[model samples]
Target: MIVTRFAPSPTGRLHLGHAYSAILAHDFARRQGGRFLLRIEDIDGTRSRPEHVKTIIADLAWLGLSWDGDVVHQSQRLSAYAGALDRLREMGLLYRCYCTRAEIAAASLSAPHGAEPIYPGTCRVLTRQNAERPHCWRLDMARATAIAGPLTWQDHGRTIVADPLTAGDVVLARKDAPASYHLAVTVDDAWQGVTDVVRGQDLFAATHVHRLLQALLGLPTPAYHHHRLLTGPDGVRLAKRHGAPALAALREGGSNGLALATELRVGRVPIGATDT
Candidate 1:
């Protein structure tokens, strides 16, 4: 059976963009008589609010979408993530990264303007470490890629070659969180037996890293559908940081959620929404 999931972080309330993604996953599963799972990516304990999780469930239900079985929370799956990290560590594909954000930014100055900062692998060669010093774990990208060999994954109908090197050596475990987004999401999807991953196009690049992780960890690679993002009046994608209105706000303000969901299904977004 086809199994898809909508995994959202509980750092903020669900907005229209979230509703669109959730509805797409839910509808796709229902159409195929598959299971739609809901997962709360709450690994970031510092920022993940329990209240936001409740609101997220409420917002999805308000939009007339439902999921099968119980909702999975990443916070409750630390041991699994740890096991994945341990396997990588045993294979010598993991290293401790002690560079701070500011230091990493300075090192990545030669990168193209407006591009994401790529780590220069300063810690990859570190022969000594202070047990007292706090450090995050980074994947030895070169070694990992060498071991995994060439890899590819299905995106929509296209077979995309995995290029995790573009992301440099990514952090797998951090001091603030037990597992990074790349590590947790990749592990969780496999553990949940997700056959399809329906998310926004913003994460399309991250799939490269996920593909590599799946190969290294001997997990299944799910089909991916990176749908276009919904934009606001300013053309910026709808996000909490972009000041997009929350679904709860719209729902409480007398907007008919069912009607909104129906319109979204036909690509008729709300006011100020622009297709990307």
Candidate 2:
């Protein structure tokens, strides 16, 4: 059976963009007689809050959406993530990165503003061992790509070539967190038997790295649907950081959630809101 998931970090409440993505994934699963799962991406221990997690569950419930099975929390699966990292390390695809954020920024001064600076492989060749120093594990993209060869993944219905190098060598495990977003999500999706990945276009670029991870880990690749994102009048995408209103606020304000969901399904966004 087809399976999809709506995974949200518990750092903030569910905004309109989040709701739209959830609704699309849920509707697609239901229409195909499949299962829709909910996952709490609380890997970032410093930022994740229990109160926010509670509100996230409440918000989704208030939106008139139901998820199949119990909710999956990323925090509870540290061992699984560790195992993946160990496997990659054994394959000589992982290396320790000791560069600080400021140092990386200084090295990436030539990169465009707001663009993610590709790591210059500063730590890729370090042979000295510093157990006392803090470090994160990064994937050697060049070496990994050499082993996996060319890769591709399904986006909507098109087969797009995987360009993991575009993001440079991504961190698979961080010193502050047991697993990076890229590592945890890829492992979780495969473990959950997720067949389809329905999310926003903003994440379309990250899929490239995910495809390479799948190939290296011998995990199955799922079909992907990069749906349009919801934005406000200013054309900026709706996000918690951007001050997008929470779904719970709309629910408590006497708004009809079922009606709102209906309008969303038809691509009708709220006043001052647009989909892009």
Candidate 3:
């Protein structure tokens, strides 16, 4: 059976973009008689709040989307993340990173593919230590790619080559958080038997690293459908930082959730929505 999921981090309330993505995943699964799942990616305990998780569930339900079986929460899967990190450590593809944000910023150089600066791999050669020093875990990208050996994944019906090196050595586990999104999402997808990943194109670049992780971790690579992101009138991406209104707020303000969802399905903007 085909399985798909809408995994949302509960750092904030759900927005229009969130509603669209959830509807896309839910509709895709239900249309094909497959299973749609909901996952709460709340591993970042510092930012994740119990109330936000409740709000997310309420928002999705208000938007008329339902999932199959129990909801999966990332906080409950720390042991699995630790196990994956250990596996990477056992393969010598994991390293301790001790760089502070300022240090990494000083070394920031714009990546050719994206405006985001890639980590310069300063901590890749650092001596591994234990609890004495607080450090995050980073993937040895060069070594990891060498082991994976030319990987690729399907995206929107095309086989795209994975170039994880452009992302540099990504953090697999943080000093504060047990697992990074890249590690946790890949592990959970395989664990839940997710056959398809429907998300926004803003994450399209991240798929490169995800494919590499799937190869290294011996997990299945799910087909990806990276849809266009909902953008503001200024064309900037819709995000909480950009002051996008929450979907629940919109519904409370008298916007029709089903009408908005159908508009998104037909590649149109929601009614009274200033954002496209």
lDDT of 3 by residue, 16-73 (tens): 7787788888988999999999999999999999998888887787777889999999
- Positional deviation of 104 in candidate 3, in angstroms? 0.4
Steric clash pairs (candidate 2):
none
Pairwise lDDT winner, candidates 1 and 3? 1
Please, what is the TM-score per model? 0.96, 0.96, 0.94
Name every residue pair that clashes in candidate 3.
none
Q: How many clashing pairs per prediction, in order?
A: 0, 0, 0
- Model 2 TM-score (2 dp): 0.96
Q: What's the ranking of the predictions by lDDT, best on top?
A: 1, 2, 3
lDDT tens per residue, model 1, 35-93: 99999999998999999999999889889898999999999999999999999999999
Top lDDT hit: 1
Off by over 4 Å in 1: 110-115, 272-276
